[model samples]
Target: MCEANAYVRQDGVEELFLEGVDKVVPMDNQLYLENIFGQKKMIAGTIKELSLVDHKIIIEKI
Candidate 1:
């Protein structure tokens, strides 16, 4: 229930990146995201915003 959906912001638009993301790990210059279903992704970006109440996470891709 604490999982959050992830989004990537580009050109002022936000796009869904991952859903139900429960884990986020910073490795080097990228972020490692893991979802509750064990889905994973590595994205090169910085966190823009985190809305816990909305269960959303926004990242600005570099």
Candidate 2:
């Protein structure tokens, strides 16, 4: 239940990228996202916000 939904801010809009993201690791210049279901993704972006109450992880593309 600690996992949060990940979103990417594009053109001032927040778009859902991943659900149940449980871990985030920074490697090189990309961010690695691991979900509770063992799914993973790597993205080149900067963290914009962490809305714990809303369970949202917002990131902005660089």
lDDT of 2: 0.93
lDDT of each: 0.94, 0.93
User: What value of lDDT does candidate 1 attain over all alpha carbons?
Assistant: 0.94
lDDT for 59 in candidate 1 is 93
Model 2, stretches more than 4 Å misplaced? none
| Residues 7-35 of candidate 1: C-alpha lDDT, one tens digit per residue | 99999998999999999998887999999
lDDT of 2 by residue, 1-62 (tens): 79999999999999999999999997877899999999999999979899999999999887
Q: Superposing all C-alpha atoms, what RMSD in Å does each candidate have to the true structure?
A: 0.6, 0.8
Candidate 1 Cα outliers beyond 4 Å, as residue runs: none
